[model samples]
Target: DAGVTQSPTHLIKTRGQQVTLRCSPKSGHDTVSWYQQALGQGPQFIFQYYEEEERQRGNFPDRFSGHQFPNYSSELNVNALLLGDSALYLCASSLFGTLAGGQETQYFGPGTRLLVL
Candidate 1:
């Protein structure tokens, strides 16, 4: 029962550059969501993918995008990064289905810490 996992515990990028982080969902789960957590702030949803399509997304810009593969794994790509993009990128997993607002229990990974220059 491997839980959700993310890569490059830490990453460094410069303004205008791009980066891609990966994630593998927990066992028996099919939905993957990406989040951004700044210092001392709660996680902000970026988007969610189920059945290989984006199902929901927050207020993030087009610079932030993602993909989910047949293996239930995911990747988050951020292009033209900015200093504000320096934050922890978190990947969470939930059961395959519609989650009720404020009721879904999301299992989060340790996160990929990104630092932008």
Candidate 2:
């Protein structure tokens, strides 16, 4: 009955560096989504994973990608990072195709804040 969770709550990197953030989906959830939230903006969708494959992606560049594991856990990998990549990276979990009132329900994990210095 574990909840959605992330690791290494905070991170620091420099330009051109590569970083990988981890996420463990909530118990019984099979889909995982990654979002990036800036200082004062709503979260921007990064990508989503289901069935151990990337099923959907946002408008981010090729540098951003992720993977879903058989255990339903996930990872967000950002390569060639820039200062603009600094943000609170959030991980949200849902039941993939199960919708309530025409909307999918998601459980979000406390984000891993990334700072590109």
- Taken over the whole model, the C-alpha lDDT of each candidate is 0.92, 0.91
Give one digit per residue, the lDDT tens place, for model 1 in 81-107: 999999999999988654464225789
Candidate 2's C-alpha runs over 4 A off are 98-103
Error of 1 at 97 (Å): 2.9
What is the clash tally of candidate 1? 0
> Which 10 successive residues of model 1 have the least lDDT summed?
96-105
**Could you estimate the TM-score for every candidate?**
0.95, 0.94
Q: Output the number of the TM-score-best candidate.
A: 1
Candidate 1: give the clashing pairs. none
